[model samples]
Target: MKTITVKRLTEAFQLEVLAGADRMDRVISRPRTHRPGLEFVGYFDFFPMERVQVLGRKEINYLLTLTVEERLLHIGNVVKYHPPCFIVTSGQQEIPYLTLFCDQEGIPLLRTSETTTEFIAKLDGYLLKALAPELSIHGVCVNVSGIGILLRGKSGIGKSETAHTLIRRGHRFVADDIVVLKKLGPSTLLGTHNVTAREFLALRSVGLINVVRQYGRRAFQDETRIVLDIELSPWQENALNNELEVIPQFTEYLGVQIPHIEIQLQPGRDVAGLIEAAANNWYLKQHGYSAVDEFMKRVEDGMQQ
Candidate 1:
């Protein structure tokens, strides 16, 4: 299981330490955070002690209503299970007894300046990205216009070169060679290149070149959800552009399927232009239009005449 440390959270969010500052390296084994609303009222049954507990405005106000000893008793029962940490959001007035109890229990008590809602949203998003299941695929992903197209082919099949051409033509580079895919959602796979090699793309003889340095920031994208899979095949005379039927194709990765297209590679084939057209075609299809279907309808109507 992938576990993130409490120290990482503090560093990422710049959380101020209230207690147990020495226990920053404690692992947050669970991805989901919790609001111990029930635990505050002495309802300890089924308390999720493994998650990062949050004390928002309501909980802090409720605790403030209690007598000093009562507050300690309730906080004592809550932290007795030894949760990973407690985050005091909304920057409310400090509850010294709660911090004192957490300090004694060696549980990290941290506070963020952001409101409870905003902070939780950001925290969950970060945790999800950090801990999502990962899969590395062999391909080059690019953003054509706004479409994320994954170019797949065997080694030395011009995947890198083709992506380079697209970059020159104003498209964005996503990943090259090995694309790391994170299953961020049930049907969404986010793909990105290795950070160490993020700025570079390779082509035979020419060697590795930094696209960002060459083309500026607009030519590079950190990650994209692959919306199209384009496979490049060696040119076959008479076999290329032979599809008469207008059926759509799809490819799958980590249980998510996206539209698919194939383009044959040959001298003067205009492969880059074809890919751009494919992306535009995909946009058209999404908006209830298909060039092939429309062409077929026109042909059928003409034949009847």
Candidate 2:
């Protein structure tokens, strides 16, 4: 199971440790956070122990309504679950015995300056991205007219060269040589440069070049949502003709299906321009304008006449 430590969350969220610093190594397996208001009221039937427990304003106010003895009893019951950590939002100081109970039980008590709603939203977003399923593919990713295009092919097939050409044509580079992909949601795949390969590209005779330094900041992008996949293959006599007959090809990655196109690589072909056109065509298709569909409709109308 994937897990994040309380210490990692603390660093990521810039949380201050109010108590239980020794238990910062506590593991949180769930990407979701929980507010145990019901558990605070002695309802523990379905409390999620593996999640980070958030003590928001509502829960803190409820605790204030209880007598000291009643407060300790409810706090004890909740802490006994050994939650990954307790985060008090809105920079609220600890309730009467909160720090004591957390310290005694070795449960990390974290405090963040952000309000309850803001902290929860930020934490949820962070955890979702931290735990998202990720994979790396050997390819070049670029943004052509705001559409993310992933170009894949065998080694030395000019992926970087094509990317360089596109960069010169005012396109933005996401990654070269290796593209790291993460599934943000059911239908979205986010692509970024591999950490070790960021801002760098390898090309024949040119060696290693820093894209940001060579092409300026506008030519490099931190990440983009991948919308299309294009696989470059060495030119075959009949492949180009066959590709024209195919419509709406798709490839599956990380449980998501993305539009896929295959192009033949040959000497003297404007591959970069082709990639740019592919991106424009994808944008048009998204808006219900398909060249193939329009042509087919025209042919049907002619036949009917």
Candidate 3:
């Protein structure tokens, strides 16, 4: 959600403008910013607004081909260009007029030792993130085989304990304590975790313990396609009405609709077994079978007979 600006770019790197130094401080229109009425000068100008500019050997070669008038035109076009911010690539190339202009105009004149290709590839990522706004949040997730599962409940509802049990039973933990949920596209949900917190699962018996230390790194998973959810709560048979023949449905978390299953918990119950059953039932549904509906059909047929 943070917008990258030209002023921010100037401060990030050592820059030395080759031309149009006077216009260095001018605002370049960023396609990411989506500002109106701005033009960009060169195809190679995909630098981050926050990057330091450096010169490469090839750019000097390009500049030598122009007449003074043509050179001025290119500089003028560059100065007048909008959006994509500029960085001359490579190290210590002389363009005195441009450098002086940059100093005077307050445009960033960055100089680096990296080749243009490498610099562009590296810095372009920052600009892309600035241009394209994506939302990321932290939470815990798991991949029950291919079925992505997310567990959420009150602070002490055994969320981490349940996740740990699943991991020991050969299910992969996507995230343990804190899970990050991101929207991939319309109607799609993806969840992952920070590396530092990925394998760390908390338990009521102790605080946070490292899963990798206890179970090894293989117990953790990078990410998963979240297809189902499990919300742990103290079991209440009376809470669920008879008309509710199916798992209660929920389609939104952090504002996204996902298939959800409310797993009401109680003492002395096999929590891991419940999770396994849920995954298996979901798998059956994925393959076009529904146990509840099938049972309902059998009951109706029996009544008719």
The candidate scoring highest on lDDT is 2
All candidates in order of lDDT, best leading = 2, 1, 3
Output candidate 3 Cα RMSD: 7.1
Writing each residue's lDDT as its tens digit, candidate 3 over 1-305 gives: 33555555555544443444445454443332221112122444443433333335655555566676666655555444332344666675566545554554456555557677776666654454344323444345888877888888878788788888888898888786677665554566777776677567778878888877888777877777778878887888788545626745875754667778777887888988888888888899889997778989999999999
Tell me the lDDT of candidate 1. Answer: 0.87
lDDT of each: 0.87, 0.89, 0.63
Q: For model 2, give the RMSD to the true fold.
A: 2.1
Off by over 4 Å in 2: 242-245, 300-305
**lDDT of prediction 2:** 0.89
TM-scores, one per candidate = 0.89, 0.91, 0.59
For residue 175, give model 2's deviation from the true position in Å.
Answer: 1.8
Of the two candidates 1 and 2, the one with more favorable TM-score, higher being better, is 2
Q: Which stretches of candidate 1 lie over 4 Å from their true place?
A: 42-48, 244-247, 296-305
Better of 2 and 3 by TM-score: 2
Error of 2 at 203 (Å): 1.9
TM-score leader = 2
Q: Report the lDDT tens digits of candidate 2 across residue range 95-199.
A: 649999998999999998899988899898788777778899999999998999899999998899999999999999989888999888999999998788889
